[model samples]
Target: MESLKNNFATKTAILVDGGFYRRRAQAVFGDQTAEERAAELANYCMRHLNFHGESSNLYRIFYYDCAPSSKRVYHPFLKKQVDLGKSDLFEWTTLFFNELKKKRKFALRLGKLAEEQAHYTLRPQIVKKLCNGSIQFSDLQEDDFCLQIDQKGVDMKIGLDIASMAYKHQVDQIVLISGDSDFVSAAKLAQREGIDFVLDPLGAPIKPDLFEHIDGLRTCNKAYTAHTQK
Candidate 1:
């Protein structure tokens, strides 16, 4: 085990929902390399030690995400049929996962993506124009169609690990970095097992049901770029 620098008496495990963090980080940090993001992730989790002026030993970090889909689809922006397998987004995601794999005490849990054809919603602007007689439905282009890709198994893996860790006594505290309320049951189970359950929503407003289940609501208050400011 790495030396426990914090003086707290608990062992803490940080579980991260990779998809949520990526979206939030992109909104806040603009754009960053995968290595930089992974480093920020570790640093963010470690900052939990400052809560209540107490410190805890870092047990591990569990990151859950789905790999990018390789399916071919109509590109709305490019206005053509495209292969996502050859897309820049796919390349970047691959690099991101590779960088995450190199972080110490970090475990990556991958899930599957299911792509299906569904009725696509027109952009709000187009819809408003049509409704107000400014445009017709015939104005909609085929490029406006989209295929939805749903993530599978990511949440299940997180919950399963929570149960496993609680039952096995792997850690005394669990810090989950997710906004999904689907974890309420799992959080309850962990809390019932005498684990200090902390939720780090990264400053996102959480549902009341989720807030009631956690022992603490903490967030990484600094922007991602703040790390470089000093």
Candidate 2:
């Protein structure tokens, strides 16, 4: 047992915030199916080591997200009522969930989407136009309306895993692919435990305070277009 413990090599773990990564990927790589997105994720994690000419001793990849909510709402573009649970968005989210389950080194951590009381609000640009008298209230269209859903428990699960990795010495490095600062405190704790903490903003601008908490910032693949086209 002692020899086995001593022989354990330093390993790297990747934690991704699925929603953040997906939005950025859609902008950078255009629309992609869940399988393509998963491949991109693994490519990003491996790129970290390849950049510095190191071999991969990947511990695992952790993905955190909330399942799509089952709620009915007005569809602006379609100009009709629809069930969010039955929308294409929901179906795609489920496909993404299932694809992750098939990967050997991937861990899918699910949370919940909380639907709040519905409220009517115009788009910010539309509101500005209305205020400027460029558009009248009577000119408002059904397409201008939008619905919002809040995700819960994702960050908590992420923080708990970070703490677990640090306390249990499960990994020597952590690569977090998230832009939110909610993980700053957890990142600090990991650093205090002598683990290297790296942040992959995936081309997003990060706040200065968040910059201070991480050992470095890196994006595994910058040529997002190349990956998507193939």
Candidate 3:
């Protein structure tokens, strides 16, 4: 316990999912103390991690969210308008049967997160193909379309920042504050190239696969220290 507690003070950068993270934070501390909690989460990482090495620049935490647009913001309500009384709208998810036909984990996470909030499903429409029945997956386009945000553009920017740092060898090691498995590929790439990777997911301990693969995995708990930031 003593050694574990001490590991938090280190050179670390946190990768956070803006929607899930903030919502989780809010769930933990309520709306009034949200910013305080965010700031405290940063401080908590610094205090606990033993980041005493060559990399002077620690990322602290990189928060990610999609870029926000009014269209994206209103996408849910508009989708609800379209899905009225429709049973095959893929049940609880905003994803149409056509949409889920072409799957991406990122899309699934975002769509499920959206449905969790009950804002109506925001799955994109596919152009039903005439040739032997296939759906053209515009949402799965690699060019970052569904990335338009309601929480706004936090996640994409966070991802780009991580990529930039990894490309530039920015930090000695990174301590991601998220558990969104979307980052697993990036983490693996970092480790394959000999960069140290770590995780400090806020509400729980480091994930088991991450623990096995990452060089360092620190556990973060809102309860250990007061969620109230000084």
Best by TM-score: 2
Model 2 backbone overlap count: 0
What are the per-residue Cα lDDT tens digits for candidate 2 across 1-230? 97766555558888989889888888877898878877766676667654544454789999999888667766655556678788688888888888888887899998887766533357788889999999997898876766666688999999999999999999998889889998899999999999988888777777878888888777666553222110
Ten contiguous residues minimizing lDDT sum, candidate 1: 221-230
Candidate 1 accuracy as lDDT? 0.81
Q: What ranges in model 3 sit over 4 Å off?
A: 1-11, 33-35, 48-60, 67-160, 205-208, 222-230
lDDT of 1 by residue, 1-230 (tens): 33564443678899999989998878766688767877777787878755556677789989999998777776655566678889677888898898888888889999988656522356676667888998776677754544456788999999999999999999999999989999999999999999989888777778999988988887766542222110
lDDT of 3 by residue, 158-196 (tens): 556666667787665666666566676677777775666
Q: Give the C-alpha miss distance for residue 50 in model 3, angstroms.
A: 4.7
Each candidate's TM vs. the true structure? 0.82, 0.84, 0.48
Candidate with the larger lDDT of 2 and 3: 2
Residue 201 displacement (Å), model 1? 0.8
RMSD of each: 5.4, 5.6, 14.1
Better of 1 and 3 by TM-score: 1
Residue 23, candidate 1: Cα error in Å is 0.7
Rank order (by TM-score, best first):
2, 1, 3
